[model samples]
Target: MSNAASAQTTKTPGPGTYRASCHCGALRIEADFDPSAGTTRCNCTICTKTGWWGTIVRPGAFRLVSGEEVLGGFSRTGAGYSHFCKTCGIRVYGHGDIPELGGEFYSINLNCLDGVDLTGVPVDYLDGLHDTWEQLAAAPHVDPVTAAKRLSQTS
Candidate 1:
């Protein structure tokens, strides 16, 4: 088995296999990830703007089941590419090469996964804006909806 397969050995109690898609259903993927292990939220310009909530897996653990022809990619830093659906513009996943992460890694957007409830999933916060990949962010990230509510209350 590949390292990606081994890494998916179910460290947490959650669905191991997930079906993911873009908003328009033009891009689809099958991913093997243990969500209970945690999802990631990065505070980088791209991630913040895209509202990315991702789970990382090696290439073997991620499969583009369909709609490859409709997938569009964008890369701001050139380290990796964020993929979205050409029709609906919903980012489904991303892939990049990060030496610290054992080379190539795939970032599956947890938001795109079908039938997965993330209500209580542990969120790993990355301070990507500061390039502190090794350190967690001082403040946990709030989703856009929550942030907006907070903004309104303080105003």
Candidate 2:
């Protein structure tokens, strides 16, 4: 496991496996645990349209259980990759490397998570529209690396 994975093991939903998927289950990822805190909402053009709500996780802690062939994705230069279920058109997850974050990270969509009710999870709203990293970094509900990524976005 990676440092991020080791870090994840110490966090919430404590050391257990949790499952998530797209609308039709055509895409699935098994996470070590559910994020019960510091998740976020992005207001960028793409995120705004898809309503993609997520929490950051290390690559080792997120396992793609299935549906690799049925998944589609979109990405832009200097931006993280957004993946979805090709059949149902449900945006499932996203990931990318953040140099400031130390390495690769997965953005797991909370809406795709099964058996997890994240209603009360404290959410940090990010200003992705204008690339507001300074403001995002100041938000109490998210990690510094995520705030860094928001700053790195290309328009």
Candidate 3:
């Protein structure tokens, strides 16, 4: 292959767009992301109940394609806005800017994504239910021992 051809082949692909929806398909959302960018799982009450965390993206990266009218918002202690589908009661996404907890970011539900392969994608589990939940909720930071143990038990 020519040098130019090889260079082009080696270039990383731009963040690809993926579509997600509520359990009842009442709300559809589109997100552009590099799956290689990694994802997370939080153990906080709401997140634990929902089974998603660290899967958030920038607000600019997400778009509501339909069913905006069916979406509802919920927040606690003025932390963030948790959006859900009114018809199906599925938590779709969340966003907020809680000054008490530094700002907020768009939290997307990975389960909502259609056909993405998450194997070997590096999942970070956080203790969002504990007193130090806030301190361990960030992404790219996983408790090595805990994550390993959890994955081992599950696998």
Best by lDDT: 1
Model 3 ranges with Cα > 4 A deviation: 1-14, 98-104, 134-155
Steric clash count of candidate 2: 0
Q: Rank the candidates by lDDT, best first.
A: 1, 2, 3
Q: Which pairs of residues collide in candidate 2? A: none
Q: How far is candidate 2 from the true structure (C-alpha RMSD, Å)?
A: 11.5
Q: Candidate 1 residues 1-155, lDDT tens each?
A: 33234222222338578778787776889887777777788888888998798888998898998888998999988998999999999999999998977999999997777655455567878888888765574343344665677789999
Q: Candidate 2 has what TM-score?
A: 0.73
Local accuracy of candidate 3 as per-residue lDDT tens digits, 20-72: 77877778888777655766676767787775644666778889988899989
Structural RMSD, model 3: 9.2
Backbone clash numbers for all candidates listed: 0, 0, 2
Model 2 worst lDDT run, 10 consecutive residues: 2-11
Model 1 TM-score (2 dp): 0.76
| Poorly placed runs, candidate 1 (over 4 Å) | 1-15, 134-155
Instruction: Report per-prediction Cα RMSD to one decimal.
Output: 8.0, 11.5, 9.2
